[model samples]
Target: MHAITPYLLKSYKGRDTEKKESEHFDLSNIKGKDLLELLHKYMQSKSAHVYDFKEEKRVFKFSDIDFDIKRRTVSAFLVAGFYGVRSDIIDKSTGEIRFPKSESDAEVLRHYIQFTVPPGSTETIGLFHKSRGVGIKSLFDKLFKANFLLETQATLQITPYAHTGAVQEWAKGASVKSLKVKGFVPSSDITVNLARLGECNTEFTISPKIKKKGFKASFGPLSDFLTPEASSTQNEIITLLSNQGASVRTVAELNGARRTFEVGANSGGVVCDIPFAEGEDEVELKGGQPEFQSTQKWARSLTNDILKGVYGRRAFQI
Candidate 1:
């Protein structure tokens, strides 16, 4: 008759914080026991899944015999297989597989347990991971284009030029007190003129010596501007441009101004402005007029109203 032997298998060591909560179990240790019966007794003794068994050669095998801690769930692989078992088997003649006898050996089992458990439960594991990945990707894409813009002049020039006289004024010695855009919308062609505190040569170049003020301009789609994608692209372009030292403000400001201009124009506010050339004698200007003078005048007036803070105050006011 084969004698069944029962032995108390040590419990796995928990991590530092969990060490106090770990439990131990004991059973009868016997020799020449049937492997399956030994496993049943071990599993029943501790209410856990550790088991030891011997094969035809009397080689000992250690197994978890329960849920896979690594996979975060109970699975057949951890129950009936050799997951935590050693590769070497003991022979009755060789005495190869031996029971662990030291604290270090018990620690090995503890590590196996700690390494198997997942950080979080199976549910909601991938929640923020997806959003975080998208945000990082978008940020990098924007940053790459911004770096590309710094190296190319043509790319900078491709942006619609406002033709503000400040470019020329900055070339001259005159200090520009204020810069305003006239007849500009998200899609409108902007025209800017610089004025000095006093009369000067109209053909004179702006001197680099003058310290120019920072520029601030807002733009949005005209009433007739129909493309939504273009509007979004323009907003992104403007943001990138501002970061590159173009001195732009919030995109919200541009959208608000556009809405105000549209409503005001519909209510009979003029939408243009026209400027008479500087230093033009009355006789030289008496009969000369551009065919688009009226339209230009309307645009100038609307832009001036926007710059003077009238449009913004009215559009966004409570």
Candidate 2:
């Protein structure tokens, strides 16, 4: 087997909110490739972005959000709610990011959660950070001797950095254009979802695509994504990607640390990391030397949690 070890270091700076803030992250796990494979799977999932969008009478109410990258975030994310999908509908339809750098394609998707509250109003609070200069594939490629170190980060303007909600990306490096989210059943309920203590999504715009076994890499236009041309199907594509992005807050913990993590991956599942304290500079893998089986174990665990969030399952399996 390929004994691939990884290392990573990252820092994040926030834009928009007052009292500008920044966070740092660290991750140098032993499960390098295993984690990478898992992350790859996550990015490839259909439910990673938005779920579903149905046009009905009275119109159950729904949302269509669009994200434009100002720069990269410290980490990327997967947010799943009511109506949307995480699957790479773009790849499925276009086979791959024809022009990942295209102002239109460089944008991030927003999942619209359609719900209803019997009597009183149901609030669907949402949290989001926007920026350009986004990128994800770089970190992915570094996993082995390969960086294994997942340097996830983006320079963003947290819509309400003070709020507890945000959006998720496959970590597929690309720039964002603009973001706009609206609609929820009853057209009133508000929803809020944020990256947990370790729930961080970040990246920079670096067009990376697969060409057989290697990547056809290139530099994507940063400004284009920031101001993409409006399209009729843009909203629909964004919705599809958003529904699939799924994440959950098990034990709500307010995390103000900006750190990065190392990773592993393959055809197997991915690794959902354990939170590392702030300023863990040059930190190594926790749990000592891991058995090959253990890597899969962690990947499986992360996959289950991700799936459960997407499907809302009490229990599950790959």
Question: In lDDT terms, which candidate is top?
Answer: 2
lDDT per residue for candidate 1 within 145-239, as digits (tens), equals: 34323422111111111211101121121222222222222322221222233222221111123344674322332222111243475445433
Where model 2 places Cα greater than 4 Å from the true spot, the runs are: 1-139, 142-272, 275-287, 314-316
| TM-score of every candidate relative to the true structure | 0.13, 0.17
Candidate with the greatest TM-score versus the true structure: 2
* Model 1 superposed RMSD (Cα): 35.4
Residue 6's lDDT within candidate 1 is 10
lDDT of each: 0.23, 0.24
For residue 106, give model 1's deviation from the true position in Å. Answer: 99
Q: Please, what are the lDDT tens digits per residue for candidate 2 over residues 157-212?
A: 11111110110111122232223221211112222233223233432221235445
Model 2, CA-based lDDT: 0.24
What TM-score does prediction 2 earn? Answer: 0.17
Model 1 misses residue 48 by how many Å?
99
